[model samples]
Target: MSTMLQWPASRPARPGDPLVDSFGRVHSDLRVSLTDRCSLRCTYCMPEQGNLWLERSTLLDAAEIEAIARVAALDGVDTFRLTGGEPLLRRDLAEIVRRLAALTVGGRPVEVSMTTNGIGLAGRIDELAAAGLSRVNISLDTVRADRFAELTKRDRLADVLDGIRAAAASGLRPLKLNTVAMRGVNDDELHDLVDLAVEHGAELRFIEQMPLDAGHTWDRSTMLTRDEILETLSARWRLTEVDGRGDSPAERFHLDGGPHTVGVIAAVTAPFCGACNRLRLTADGQVRNCLFARDELDLRRVLRSELSGTERDAALDSVLRASVLGKQAGHGIDDPEFLQPGRGMNAIGG
Candidate 1:
């Protein structure tokens, strides 16, 4: 763990006083990474050899994570999304969810969710839902068993499918499916994936391939853009843009004459930074204002420091404020001078 910073006492932010960046964007959604350990080695996310996982001792315990969420809730962060290389890999995740779900900000109950690869979710969906998990976003690129193995380097398509079914059966309402679309990869299975979502009454979202691969070899040439994905899907089914976008990263749409809905996150093609309201916390306790940020504030040190509860809370408020204030105007992915962050998507948490 990093050494604690010498932070002076700062006033806690009230529920109305949100964590706003320099650009006046109020951040209310927090994505916390539980761990960097994952089961599959997805080609788009990590290298085949895989990266070293963080030591268990360095990770934030369930109590520490709850404390962070409590501090965030005080500052108007109502939605907390737990993420990881694969969040289901964490054994105590249900307990963490239970703790966060008990938090209320300004009398409103905090919403707790998780984003997982769905490898181990089938058996635990009931447990997670019973523990107060509101919903889940499972990462599934293709439904074909062979394609799944080729993409993730794992033959677990059956397991993921089972998990999706379990999520719906367990009443994880508004269950979401996240697919990273690439040019010649799972792009061909777009309509099929949508069909699966429709059958399960789940919201399916196609995310553009990002440059967060561990190998740093992501080529825009091979990446499927938002327009391409929409065009392809339109050829198969009619889509109407849904109203009320409201600071969401995904552009939501509904299948014409049907109740099923789908979304596309065009991070590279259609930058949504101007309305971005999300912040990130790595498993080790670093706070990042942006997913593509080059620097982070080490809040774990303060949380683990020899300080009183009041002192730690004050320091956390200050650190969070500093990180938000330092947020860039945009991610700059489309800029000529743009460069991908050194860390991969797995390490950075989705």
Candidate 2:
């Protein structure tokens, strides 16, 4: 187990960097990676030879994460989600959630959420919910046991199902399931997911396979378009679009039967760059302005060393300043000639 470290006292915070995109969207959400480490080895998200793990000493502790969350809250970031290769791999994860849940800015509590691979969630879900987690998004690409093993190189389907059940039982209301639509792979499971959502009253979201991972060969034909998924799902159940929501990438729709919804996230084929409101903080104390960004602000030095409250606030200002300016109009991956940098999605904290 990793030893707990003391965090410096909170500093008087300042406004966060305002991200006004060309599409009239302001960035107001942040995804903080507690660890780039994960147990699953999904073929589309990782390379056969994975990335070197980040140094433990350089990682931002739970206190620092909450402190940063408070700073971002001042900047209009009210929603924060903890993500990782699989966030449950972090031993102090529940404690981290507790710290983040205790944070508030401008007299308002920030919404806390997490995305996990569901491997260890069965045992941890209740504790996490008790610690102030409002929602959870579990990654479940395939349902078939053998197919899941072949895709992730792991055999934990029963555990995954148990984790989902635990999340629901723990009152992680409206729990979401994320599945990446890979060509010829798991596309047939579209109806299966809809059935799960309909039966469990959970929201299942289908994501487009983007080209930002280490396994870089992307076949357009194999790519499942958002329209295709909707068309397939609508056949069985009628879907009505929901209204009055922030700039979420997913298009939410309600099932005809009752109070169930399924969302389609089409980041690649239908770019929502204009409405993108998310900023990323990697496990190694760096801020990523965009998913396809090649540069990151190194904040580990300040977090580790002795810096006055004013100095820390200055560092946060600098990081956010650099981040907003670096936001891209859109990921240039559509240009078939582009090459991606950085590690796979797992290493990059998807």
Clash count of each predicted structure: 0, 0
What TM-score does prediction 2 earn? 0.90
Q: Model 1: per-residue lDDT, tens digit, 1-350?
A: 01112223485444336787767788889999998879898998887684777888889999999888898998888999999988998889999999999999889898899998887798898888889999999888998999889988889989898888888788877899999999888888999999998888898999988888878899999999999999999998789998888888999998985688999999988988888889999999899989898899998999889976888888888899999889998998877998888778888886
The whole-model lDDT of each prediction reads 0.87, 0.78
Work out the TM-score per prediction.
0.95, 0.90
Clashes of 1: 0
Among all candidates shown, the one with the greatest lDDT: 1
lDDT of 2 at 285: 79
